[model samples]
Each structure stands twice: as C-alpha cells, then as structure tokens.
Target: MKKLILLLLVFPFFVIAQDLPTVYPFISEGAKYIDREASIALEINILERDISTGNIDSNLLDFGLEVFEYYNKYGAISEDVYFEYLEQSEYGDSWLSCIVPDYVSSTLKSQGNNSYNKSNLGDRDPRTAWVEGADGYGIGEYIEMRVYAEALKDLRILNGYQKSIKSWKDNSRVKSFKVYINNVPVRILELEDRMGEQIISFDDLLPEGFDIWSAEDFEIKLEILAVYPGERWKDVCISGISFFGCYC
Candidate 1:
C-alpha cells in the first residue's frame, strides 16, 4: 500500500518534467491567443515581454511555468487575459530549407568524373562542384538553376570549384553575370574575382507596382558573362548555390 502511494506521488514530477512546453521558435508576430487556464497566464506574459526586448533567457520555474508579466489593454491584467505574440514580417519559408533541385544545369561535363557535373550544384557540399570539363574556360558558359520560390529575396553562390583552399582560385570564377526569372531578364550583377560565397539580395523581388509577391515558378539563370581564370586550369566552375526566402 505504501509503495503504491509513493509511486503515485513520484509520477507527477516525472510528468511535469517531460511535458514542460518548449518556449522557442515562436514566430515573431503580433498575434493574440486565448486559453482557459489561469495558471498559464503569468508564464505567457513574461515570455512575451522578454522576447520583445530581444531577451530569450526567460526563466521557467520548477513548476514548468514560464514567468512573464501579462498586460491587459481591455481589462485588468489577470491570468485569464488574452495574450499576443510577435508576428512574422518576412514571407515564405527559408529558401535553403525546402528547395528541391528542379533543373540545375551547366554547359558541359567533366569527362573523367561525372561527380563534378552540373547536378551537384544543389548538393550543398562545397567539395563537389558544377564544373565545365574539357570545354575549358568559355566566357559565356553558365550555371542555371530552375528555382521554385515563393518570394526570392536572397541568392547565395559559393563561386568557383573550391575543392581546397589552393584550388579555389584555380578555376574560372564568375566576374559578371545576368539574373533571370522565368527566362525574363531581371538584373545583371558583377562580382569581384574573389574566393568564397557571394550574396545577391533583393528587398522586393516583385516587379514595380506589384504588391503580392515574386513569381514562384522561377528559372534562375547565372550566365557567365566574363571570368577570371585560375593559375593552372581554364575550366569554369561553381561550387555551391543556395537561395533565401520561402520555397514554392
């Protein structure tokens, strides 16, 4: 009888520990929610305040309750008061998070090892690359990705065939290029003959006078207009590529 009573008493602690709701990943949006439970009011209030001031270290007591001060605009700030959270300003999911390789293509193939083909561009590994094989460093050679994004805001390119620190500058790097969406020319970008990743960001990818969002079914083309070839090789290469914003 005593053992049964002790087990019942100990079970609640285990349950509490296991069920403490993680108070993270809350979308930063000014949205309100209502709950029937009064015990949770204080916890919500404290968390809401901390997050607003860029404070993430809000304490959750042993009771597994986040300590936050609730403020009620309509009535007394009580446990039953409705709460609001930060609203998300940015639209769409992360571009890199959910992108699928639609049609990542390059000009030619490396005859010896197909591993360095254009298909490897979306693999996210910098070691493998989309390299123009025996074709040599052709200025017009390009690496085009058929991107599908909700709102394309940022484009990051790990330029060059960077298998090693020494090999990074050993290939033709993109010096000037044109950006295309769905085969429609949008903008042209010129990058320095530099090693490492380069980013092209857009505040509003939508065309002028359009408020909705950018096109989702996009054919993003990175046509090599000019290049700075490496010391030894004359091959054009792109190591990695990633887009930002939500995927369609």
Candidate 2:
C-alpha cells in the first residue's frame, strides 16, 4: 500500500515533466553567443507554431520565454512610455487612450446605500469602488473584464477605497493580485500599501509571438491573493481599473 501511494504521487509529476518542453536544449552555445536576437526570434517562431498546432503547451512556452527574458535582462515596460503616450494624447494623438472594458464582473459585491457594483471599476473615478461582499478579508475573490486586445500594453489600477482619506484607511486594500490572461495564470502584481495608481506592463509577461495588434479580444481576471487589512472594515475594495492601448 505504501509503495502504491508513492507511485500515485510520483506518476503525476512524471506526466507533468513530460508535458513541459525542453526549450533550453534547442539553443546552441554558438547561437547564444554569436547572434542571440536572431536565434531567440527563430526559436520563438518555431515554438509559437508548435503551440498553435497543439504540439506544445502554451504554459510551457511561457515558462521557457520567461527564463530567456530573465537571462537576457529584458525589462518590463517603463513609466516613461506611458507618460510619453499621455503627452501625445494631449496633442490630438487619438490613437491611444485608456480603454474601458467591454464587460466587467466580480465574484461578489458588497451591498451598501451607494452602489458597489463591478461597473465602478471602469468608471475612472477614485471616489467609487467595487467592494467584495465576501466575509472576512475577501481573499480568493476575483474580478474579471473583457476588452479588445489590439495594442493593449499596460494595466492601471487604483487600489483601495478612495472616497476620502478616512474612507481609504477604513477599508482593506489588495496587497497582491494573481493576474490571469484568458484564464492562464500570467503574473502576480504586488501592490504597495500607499495610495496611488499602480501600473503593470504586459511587455515582459505576454507570450512570445502574441501579436497584440492582431489578436482577438481576450479576458483578464485579477484574483485577490492577499490584502492589507483595514483598521475598521473587513471588506476589500478596488477603486478603478483602466487599460492603456492604441486603437490603431
């Protein structure tokens, strides 16, 4: 019986290991040192094709790309890019804007005199919020939105209740969020306890060969993994969420 149980546990791990691609073995020492960009690009194309044909798992590809990106010291999208786009938008640059999602929904919503529905997340108002109705700190709750993926580059979130300083302090805030793109776990966004907008760039996280300009619309879900407890309230709140992208 002991041996049978051990085999059962080890069998699953063996299957998982088989499912993951051997991405590193494909890169030669010469390719890594001689023409890294060209080599990586070629491998990415081949991997993408295999993924599309169901020959390789998408998650495995993501893991492989992340390893390469880390070794290459590729950085996430910078605030400067966001600021530059903002400046251009002021001068009739209609190509880019804060995208309001086509649909927004939450697992639970707190009932109150004022509305605390999912719609509040995209209203662009820090004063209003989507509060989780769950008991305690509302861990494990989630909010999801669907938006056009074309040129989608960044995600902006205003964490916690922001009606007033008092309100912000009275309600709980998200400390970490597990972000999922189209139901595949992508990144975990760790937020500061302080009040302000937090930006998350997709530049480093998106799967290789995913053309944001041509892909169909996709869903993004943010699951609350942890929270900064409030002094007075058990409910957790998020003031707003906005997507930065170019329509063209």
Candidate 3:
C-alpha cells in the first residue's frame, strides 16, 4: 500500500516536471479555455487629460482587457476575462490604445528602413545558401523579430522562388530561401528576376481580415530561391530591407 501511494505522488511530480516548461502560464487567470468557435474582443482607451497636451505620459494610458465568450457543455452561456496588461502609446498630443482603428491601420504600410542580404559567395563556397548564420547568422537567430521605438525593423523575403527558369536541366535551379520574422515564417516569394532588384510589398498579399499589427512585437519569415551553376545563388545580392508603422 505504501509503495502504491508513493508511486502516485512521484508520478504526479514527474508529470508536472515534464509538462511545466512547455506550458506557458497565463499572465491573468480566469476560466480555462480551448480554441473552440468563439469571439475574442480587445480594446484600449485613452483619458482626455492625457491627450490635452502635446506630450503623452505613457503611464496614464489603459491597455484594457482580453475577453472570451463561449458556451458550456450544458448549453449555458459563459464569458470570462483572461489576462490583463498595460498598452503602450506613442509620444503625442492624443492618447490612444490598441482598440482604436487608426492605431491598427498604421501597421498596414512599410514604416522605416531595414535591410537583409546574402553575403557574397566565392567560387566553390558551401555556405552560399540561405541557412541561419552565426554572428547573427540567418536561421534561428531570434525567437521573435520586432520593431519598437527608434530601432531597426526586421525585413523578410517575400518568397522562396520569385520566378521559374528553363535554362537548367530539371531541379537544378535554386528553389527556395528562408527568412525569419518574429521568429515565425510569414512570407515566401518564389524565384523572380535575379539580375535586377525586385520589390515585394506585403500589404497586397496579407490574408483578408488580418488586421495590421498594433503591438510593438510581431513575427514573420520570408524565403528566397537560388539556382546552382552559372546562376549560383552566391552570385546574388540582397542590398537591404526595412519595416515601418506605429506599434500600439
């Protein structure tokens, strides 16, 4: 009997120890939830006093609550508040929060300048492809890429292949490239014109109803394609890239 009881206690500890690290704790607590069909509403508000002056006190803004509504097993309705956090604002005369439309719209366009390029490749260099680099190499460099305040923004390639080439025999052409945004893969432009600069604008390709990122933190990734031989990817050059927008 003692052994059985001990096994139960030890088992629980082992399970918790293994699962604890993977489970992200909630900043604020309420009812537990699953991603069932439900509605999530986020809001932000600014006090009139804070906007009266041209300068805004970041301390005076309210971030608001994250709410979720769903139905219980018995068909009963339920609503809960999940987490609490303070929203940040720009230094301006008017106060603003994430809930406002203007704050969300600002992220729609390219904001500032940030660039990424593949280093020059020598005649017979193996590191000519788009693998993560050391000294802040390409892949797995950061868990998340973001732009906040007066800092460099992360730039992502639109796709792996911008165009198709028939000169090479079959699959000899560079098929894809990789870029990371906020530690996640978001865009991938296929093979295109390799000689001249090709521009990619993300606003045109973003998913419908996907609101512009209002928070200071966001994640995205990009992939570019490279071919071998005369058109070896090593010969290509990515001058630079950038991002711009107000993060609410």
Error of 1 at 25 (Å): 29
User: What local lDDT score does residue 248 receive in model 2, on the 0 to 100 scale?
Assistant: 47
Off by over 4 Å in 3: 1-145, 148-175, 178-184, 223-237, 244-248
Give a tens-digit lDDT track for model 2, residues 91-178. Answer: 2212334344444444254456678877777654557788888778988888777767776777777778877667778899998876
All candidates: CA RMSD in angstroms? Answer: 26.6, 18.9, 22.5
lDDT of 2: 0.62
Global fold similarity of model 3 (TM-score): 0.28
Once superposed on the true structure, which residue ranges of model 1 sit more than 4 Å away at CA?
1-114, 134-136, 204-214, 246-248
Q: Candidate 3 lDDT, tens digit per residue, 1-248?
A: 99999999899766643332111111121322211112212121122222334244444344322211111122322222221222232334332222111111011112154112232111111111112223211222221233342322222221121222222211122233433344333333343323222333345333334454544544443333233333443222222223433333
The TM-scores, one per candidate, come to: 0.53, 0.59, 0.28
In Å, residue 23's CA in model 1 sits off its true spot by 40
For all candidates in order, the CA lDDT equals 0.53, 0.62, 0.28
For model 2, name the residue pairs that clash: none
Give the TM-score (vs. native) of candidate 1.
0.53
Instruction: Output the lDDT of residue 31, model 3.
Output: 24
Q: What's the best-to-worst order under TM-score?
A: 2, 1, 3
